[model samples]
Structures are given as C-alpha cells and as structure tokens.
Target: MKPDKSRSGCPDPSTNALQWGIKVKSSNFLVIESDASRAQAIVSALSFLGYRPVLADRVDADETGEQWRGAFVGTVEDEAQLEQFLASLGRNARNLPMLVAADSPVATSLIADDARSQLIELIDLPLRYERLAEAMRSLQTRVEPIAASRRFVGQSGPMQRVNALIRQVAPFDSSVLVLGESGSGKELVARTIHDCSPRRDKPFVAINCGAIPAELLESELFGHEKGAFTGAISTRKGRFEMAEGGTLFLDEIGDMSLPMQVKLLRVLQERVFERVGGNRAQRCDVRIIAATHRNLEEFIERGSFREDLFYRLSVFPLEMPSLRQRLEDLPALIGEFNQRLVQRGLSRVRFAPSAMNALRQHGWPGNVRELSNLVERMAILMPHGEVRGMDLPEKYRGALPIEEVTGAALIAMMEEQPMIADSFAYGEGDPSVLPLEGLDLKDHLAGIEIGLIRQALNSANGVVAHAAKLLRVQRTTLVEKLRKYGLSETVQAG
Candidate 1:
C-alpha cells in the first residue's frame, strides 16, 4: 500500500545530512522537546531536509490548523519527571506516534518496553539526525489522515440508526447529549458528529467530569488566570478556550457536583464564562456534546443534576446501545479490533469458533469498550496462536456459544450480571434455587472479586503477569486465585 501523507508536507528523506536546521512554515512538523537546544537542532535538520518544523513545549495539534507529521517527546532522566512526561504523552500522543529521546539508556529502555507499543517510539540520546528523520517518516505513515472517519465499524441495526442520527444532526450547532453505559464508545459517537459537522476543522476536546476533582474542575473547564489559586503559577487556558471553535465533550457529566452543574448550566445558557479569578466574561463559540452513563432524569428528580442544564445539553440526545443490544456487530467489531492490533505490530490472531461462541454468550456490561478491551486482551495475552474456547475466561466457558448472545436479551443479560460470578449467582445453584441477594457481604465481595479477576484476566487475555497489573494486585495473588477458582487449566504459561 502507498504510504499515507500527513497534512504536514512530507520530509524529503534523500536530503544531505550536513544541512541540519529547523523550518516551521505554515504548520508542518511539530517539535515537542524539553531541551531547547536539541529541539532547535532537530528543527534545523528538518528544515534542511525540506520539511517545516514548529517548536513548542507542547502541541495541542487538535487545536491548531496543522496536522502533525511527527513529534519529539523528551523523557527526562529523573524518575519523578519520567512518569509525568510519560503520563502527559499518554494522554496527548494518541493521534501522532512519538519518538521519545531520553538522556539515559535505562530510562529509554523502560519507556521502550512499556509505552512503545501504545504510542511512543523510543530512541536513545546522542541523537542522530538521520535516525530521527526515518522515525518521523515511519510515524507519518501510521497516522491515518485526520479526516472524517469514514471508518464506522459496526453494521448492526442499532448502529445503522446511530449513523442515521449522526447524519441528521451533523449540520447543526445544537447541544448533544450522548447517553450510554460505560465503555459503550460514546466518545466515538461524539467524534462522528464533530467530524460530520461544520466544525470538522476545529478542535474536539473531551473531558471526563468525574476524573477531575471538584476543586480544580472549574479551572479545567473555564480556565484560570495565573496565580488564581495555590498551584496556579502561570495562567493556563481552560478546555473551553482551547476548544474555542469545535466540540467540547463532557463525559460522565452526571458525576459533576451540584455547584459545578450550576456553573456548567450557566455556560450552556449564556455561551460565556469568566476565567477563574478573572472579572471579564469570555465568549466561547464551542459546541457542547455531553455524555453520561447515569440516568440524568433520575438525577434531576433527586436534585443532583440541574433540569435546565440537562435540557440544554440534551437538545439532540443520542442513546448508544450496549454491546448485547447489537450482538450482530460483534463479528465486525472483532474483525476491526483484530485488524487494528495487527496494524500496531501484534502477531495476527483469531478467535476459535468455540471461543467466539463463548464471547457471544457473556453479558458485556462494559459494553463495546469492555468487549474491545476483551478482544485486545485476547489478542496480546493469547499464546501467540489461535484463541480457542478453552482460551476464554471461566465466565464465558460454556453457557452458550458466543453466537447466541445478541440484541435486547443480551442487553438484559449484561445489565443484570456484569461478570461471571454475577452470572452464576443470578443464573442457578445446587438442588434448589438460591437467593444471592440475601448472601452475606463476604460472599458478595468474593463473587465480585472473582468477577473482577476474571475480567482482568480477559483484559490481559489470560496472561497472568499482565492480568495482575490490570487488577492492581500482585502476580502471586492473581495466580493463587486462578488456582483457587480451578482456572489453572486455562492459564497458559507466559
């Protein structure tokens, strides 16, 4: 396949090595580095090679007009800074593949092993101009051009309806409320709307309301002036200012505290907000796209979420269906995830018929997000080979072949029991029917623990070590439970 060219002008790889300098014209290659000198050097080299390079401590490429061709993220030698650097990169590096240049081999090796697959491409220090150029070229090809994602995955009836809704609402500037359970890919739906809308060329910023603490939430949403609070050493633009002309996706909006809700409601109503500690009201031209797993109507009734705010946000409500509600799409989703994994350098892997049948049987309470995580886990955690029914976690082993799980019934199943223990506890027992609801806290906790371990295992694709990390428990703890649960037979030696 011909390599895709980024909106940034492609670098002339055949240029002479001696003329290394930076050329940041109309907006081409973006350079993000901690060392000002190295950044200058890299930029100079790119300029010599007939490519434009812009230098900035950070590049919110989504906000600017230029599509980034590649990035130079510097990982500091200090262990403390390394994590912060990696975390920053983790959040922003999804779109552009990054080349991480570190001062020490140890730091470089750690980043390479951990984050190389996900986003960063690690390169040891004492930088070579040619090597950096090659890395940039390779990355430029990987990033599918940031155009309207013609890449809709699911073809089930619900998804078709979703597509129809997107088409209907794409042209307008109405507030959108995306309702769905966790992991249902509500953000993807939001992106589709933004992509198809008149604001396609503008920024699309997403914030999880629950993720930010209430104390800092105001500044994050509305921005704050320098020295506004204890840690506000410098003025920082809020997500609203950053996403001035595009869409602002407020995820998990139901979790916002009452005070925050009132503030957000004011913004929605007036289309203006004053920066924290600032007297002037700034006008914001951004479109509001909010999503939540909670029932906002119930929250409104309970006086948790504001009624006026909910109405303003829900002007164009779009309900995202859970995975089971769209079971027919599982096959397509699996194929898409598989393709993505392979493209990201994973060995080609496929689910065995029995394994796939098992997948279809389980309640995907986590929705498509859960299913996608499961699929990725299966891809990487499977023993470098085909994933058979026996490869599946215990929860999905034999209830029904994966194929039978579909539609609204599947939705009911997922909603009822999010995991294996939930299934067993809810489904059946010994000689007579048993009531799990009346069970003691220990049994309830155990049931939930087992379910979480199994889900973590599925997320790790049964890799004990990786599964432990997902569970945030020791490897031994996970292994002991695997044995205690009589899951040893399914544990592949990793």
Candidate 2:
C-alpha cells in the first residue's frame, strides 16, 4: 500500500480551477497518465471537481500498513505493476473513490480491466467543465445520509418530493393507492405509510391478490365458518380480521374478480362482512393500502375496473418514479446498495466509475428491484475483488454507456468463452417463448395483457376482481380481456 501525498490540498474550483467557477468538493483523486499533458488534464479536471489531486510515482505506506484514502498512480505501463498497485489499496479500494487518467485509447481499457479503481467520474482530455460538474454533484449525493427511513433512496428532486409526500400523508389513515411499474418498490411505500401511521404497533398484514386463488380468496379475506364448503372443515379468520387495527396491504388489488369486487365493495361500504358460510356480519377495523404496477384507467375503459372502487381506494395516490427519470439518484442508490450488500455478507463487489456511468445510462425497465438483484448477482460472480466494466454481465456489457470496441479482439474473446453462449441458451426449449413480431402492435400488446391476466387469475384462483386488481388493471378490463382471450372458460368464479 502506498501512502497518499497530496500535491495540492483539496482545490476549490471557485478559487483555483477555471470555467463556471462552480464550487465543488471531492475527497481525493488519482491521476494515472504516462503523458505529462494528460496528467495535467487529469489534475485540472479533479481540481475543477473540487478534489485534492495527487500525482505520485507510486503509492507507499504511512506507518502500520495503512494507505491514504487518496492516491494517484502516474505513468503506468505494465499490467503487473497496476495490479500490484490496486492490490495494495485493499478493501479501502472499494470505498475510496478514484479517477483514472490515460490516453483516449487506453482510458477505455483502463475502465474495463481495473475493477478495484472506484472512479466516480471520468475525464476525457480537452475536458468539458459542465460535464465534470455534473459528475461531481452525482458523487456528493451518493455519500450523504438520507433524511428519512423510507425505502426510496434518492437525492433527486422527484424523490425529495416523494419523501415530503410520505411525511405529509403518513400520519393519516386515508386509503392510499401506490402507482408504479413493476419492481418500483410500491409495496415499500405502503410499508412506509404503515410504519408512519397511528396503527404502527398493530400487525401489518400483506396479501398479494394476484398470488391467491379466486376459489379460496373469499375464505382468505372473509373468515369461513367450519364446513363452509368442501375444504372448510375448520373455521379460520380472514386477513381483514387478522389485520384488525393495523394496515391490510392488498398488493395487486387490480386482480380481484367481479363477484369478489362486489363483496369487497360491500365490506368497504359498511365496514362489516359475514363469514363465507355464517350469516354473522363482523365489524371491521383495518386501514387499506393498495399497490399495483398496472394502469387502472386503461382497465376501467375496458370495463374490467369499477370507477367507484378506484375513487374509494385512492384517497391519496403515491406515484413512484422510474430509475431512468431519477438518474441523479443513481450514485446514492449505488452507494446505499453497496453498503447493504456488505451487511448481507457480500462485500467483494465494488462499482468502478465506468460501471456506475453505465448503470446511469442504461434504461432500467425493471427499475430498482432489477438494479438490486443485478448488484447481488455481480457481488456473487465478479472476480474476487471489484466489479469493473468487463466484470458486468454480457447483456449489460453491450449496452454499456461507452462506444464498444468491436471486431477481432472482442469476437475472439467471445469465441474463447463459448460457455457464455451456452449459458444463455440453457432454457431455449421452454414452451413459454412466444413470437409477436408479425402481429399487430395493439393485438400483440393484447396477448401480453391476456397472458398476464390469465397468469394472475390462475394464481388468484378464479377471482376475477382480485386478479384484475393484481394485474393493476380495472375489473371491467380484466373481464373484457377474459372474454376476448376466451379466458372466461377457465375463469370459473367470474
């Protein structure tokens, strides 16, 4: 490990650096360029970004085997030397952010090969000041502590509004409808609402309407008396009863069957419900917080969702932002997730500057959940130290933010690794593969809709309303889809 020697103690962009003179601050930076001009560019960019730039021949130790958080490895030529330098950084390499400087051609290779270098930002020579500032802002946000204990971790303006809304409505008992795409943490918002509510002490019961069967849903919701039906040998209290004074989170509420919708509407209207077989109407006391990843309006237009039910559920609506829309929050999210991964026992993975840059650029259709899962997978698979650009999965590598190096080199590498191709083709024989290339766009979309509805229905067990809610569409739309797709034949409860 090399002891860090700061050439210039933390340079303030406003005073020492040029351009818009925006104030910036970064812990430290490493300038690893063999060329003096490139090294100067690296220093100038770091200074503009408000970092203490250090130019060193090699990283050395302070005393008791402790290397400084800041380091700069200038004029590097050999791979073995670079590897040895990174190895000296140890676990600190994963935490202490770095910035690398090399020729234009070498910069790409540096980012791809060195996983231990936690470069928060990259500087291409003849640097653009505005780009550097943006990168600096991103790094600062990721390291700061969040103000609230919300599942959402972001410093972006949209997320700030989200936090404010959670604080405003959390104390109230009004029913909340969380709207967001799949894997956007809608349920997490529901949990936050419950945690902030007056009923925080009570049990928070969560039921995935899409996961239950229509036949058993009624029993699951409204307690069934002994011998209520063929499987009702024993009486059991429903979810609402179990929830009691606490919150009853209905995930995929858009998937409920029409008949069940009527039953549920009646229960909500009167705050009372009878057992499946028994005629005793029990008093209900539970707060409802529902979440769905589908658009309810489309369902209502299709006649599958009741407009009245929508109004009843959405006393307040909380919409979660997609990851792409909140790009500013990527750094913070990456930092938080990295810390969480460490807590969960996987501490080897660390994001290089290029990797983080790639993460921000890619469209995370699956959203935060996908990022979280990918991070976990990376932690498990990356070569023993840090996760760099090349360490990323193949799908992500092609979609990397940077322009790829093509032809012979990459092709030969891919050919050498035939197992990568083999792994991707492992499940090729699955029957679920459906091609919609020739179908009309609307019809193709309809098939997907029908498939999701049917899957939700089967999983919910013939509960049309529950299935509708689970699919995040209206009950009417679900019904229409059932009829349109000939799913009505299989959906018995409807």
> Per-residue lDDT for 380 in model 2?
81
Q: What is the C-alpha lDDT profile of model 1 across 326-413, one tens digit per residue?
A: 9889888877776666655665567877777787888888887777677778777873888777667667666543233322333354
**Tens digits of lDDT, candidate 2, 1-494:** 64332544544333443222223233244445567665566566666455555444333443113433444444575433443454444433333344443443334434542222334345444556776566555444433322122367888888888888888998988889999988887877887787777877565667778777888789878878889999666666677886677788888988987778788888888999998999988998999988898789898898888888888899999998988888888777777777766654566467877677667667899988788788779878872676656557766654442223222333344357454323222322322444444323343343345446656877889899888878898888777666544457677665
TM-score of 1: 0.64
The positional error of residue 57 in candidate 1, measured at the CA in angstroms, is 13
Name the runs in model 2 displaced over 4 angstroms.
1-150, 398-494
Please, what is the TM-score per model?
0.64, 0.52
Alpha-carbon local distance difference test for all models: 0.68, 0.64
In lDDT terms, which candidate is top?
A: 1
